[model samples]
Target: MSKRNRASVSLPKGVHRVISRGREYFYYQIGRGTDHEGDRIKLPNDPRSPEFWQAVRQAQGLIGQVPADTIGALIDAYETAWPGLPRKLTEGTREQYRRSLKVVRTAWGDLQASSLKPSHVQALIEKLGANTPGSANNVLDALRAMCRWACGPRELLDRDPTQGVVHFDRGEGHRPWTPEQLSYADEHLTGMLRRAYVLARYTGQRASDIIRLGWTDVDDGGFGLRQKKTGVRPWCPIFPELDTEMSKWERRPGPFLLQDNGRPFTTNQLWKVFNAAREETPLDGAVWHGLRANAAIRLRQANHSIAAICDMLGMSPPIVER
Candidate 1:
């Protein structure tokens, strides 16, 4: 392939030109010293053409006319400011927000934040609730936080659209696995699946944390780490059951659990394997997370106080109480 000639053509203060694949494309920057400073509006036309100039002026006019306090803009600003905030978002939480943001964008991305009515939010929630109430509730919660941030010292919005939007009741989530179900899983699950199950049951940690556990995490008759979801560092004594399970387990190169190819299990991989194991058992509605609940219940049965249980599970007292 011949080397393509590239040239920089000076345009307006906020506009520039670049050549890629022998085609010139123009980009207009929003401005300097703003959340979207580096963001550029791409104009897919010949930069020297009259149509291109017309398009640039039209885009500039639209940018000037549209308020910067749209729902999409506020979401961007909130994300840009999130890292500097006192309350930090966990990785899992950030991922959840990213997913929820897609839903929010689909509904009210371009709507002016201050002009959004409670009824609009309520309608979106109702529509989402019809199919996936839990997901709808999650989106509602995320939107509420974003709106609250907008309404804070920034005063991006005069009112919050999520102010009175009711979240659909999802009810108590995944239940604890019964002793018999636990025994069934113990007997039936093998290899990485069995190790993951035992680890989750013993540590009362989420699947994401449990799958990431390694030999380094085990020390001084216990294993501990700062949880990814909550950022709480929990050190729990290794139970006899977990010890026995680990004793018989073959050590893997990476994480405690490995896929057939010996790579550490991704979240989706672990879920698929766990679901396969669940399919073998007679237990219905028993998820991998249910083991965490089962572990908490076992601690409760052993007469551990709520506070102690909270510490063991790395959960807040309110959550454990719930």
Candidate 2:
């Protein structure tokens, strides 16, 4: 909390200390020239202290912060170091990882990371999946991934506790969007709502890939991308249905799906907007991923083989069948 302690601390981006009087006052500032210009929030002086980060989170109005130890502390370290990791994670994938990690931290924050065992993970699966197997599988996958990351490169764990664990039977998984529901979405949805649906339904790309797509990805033949989740690169030619809609729209220099500031939407930001629009229509049970399933269905209906669908969508055959 004093100037001396902060002398050795490196401030995060957008944060700075001003020497007002004999004390160093820290503040997080944003939008130097934009409309939100001059926005600043005071922070604790000691950047080495957890209290400093707690104040940072409070300033950003972020949730799911715990200042304590064991599993919770490990999760915090992972969260902080993830962005700087060698692999570039898509915003949507980050959101997905965060969701699962939150579940683990909520239940076992007090447990030591090294104390985790397969039995504990299995028990957690049952407790989480007693009602929603799908959710439990997601949590299990997240925990396993975190443990794997912690084991490698970071060396935060001695071993993976989720090593022996497997996913619960999430029967049928996500319900693929029916033709009628998609039809409803196509007719009712407009602008980015329509663009988002069309991209997912036509390309069979996940929300992560969709958000990363820009006009630059498109060429004379199709749009190309290396999938965020699977790392498979697929060149998706424009479909007739999709071509008709996108052709009518004004082409942008960056991503087709843009926020007001001409920047691509983050996964959570797009979901809130996309779902908010979906609620106004009768497209019941419509999720962004559901449209990817619908894309496979369309491909299959056109006599494209399962192998082709798998290759195109960057999905495994088992998942394609599902």
Q: Count clashing residue pairs per candidate.
A: 0, 0
Judged by TM-score, which candidate is best? 1
Candidate RMSDs in Å, in order, are 9.8, 7.6
In model 1, what is the error at residue 256, expressed in angstroms?
Answer: 0.1
**lDDT, candidate 2, 1-322, per-residue tens:** 3455446455666777889778778898876557876678888765544456667766666666545336766766566555555586665567777988899989888687778889999999988889888889888877776778788655678898987778786576566887688778767787787788888888889897898887788877577888877677877778888888778778768788988777789888898887777675667567888878788788888998888788778888898877
Over all chains combined, what TM-score does candidate 2 have? 0.68
Candidate 1: list runs displaced more than 4 Å.
1-67, 251-253
| Full-model lDDT, candidate 1 | 0.75
lDDT of 1 by residue, 37-103 (tens): 8656786454433334445565676553434556766676566555555688887788888899889
Each prediction's Cα lDDT score?
0.75, 0.76
Compare the candidates by lDDT and give the number of the best one: 2
TM-score of each: 0.76, 0.68
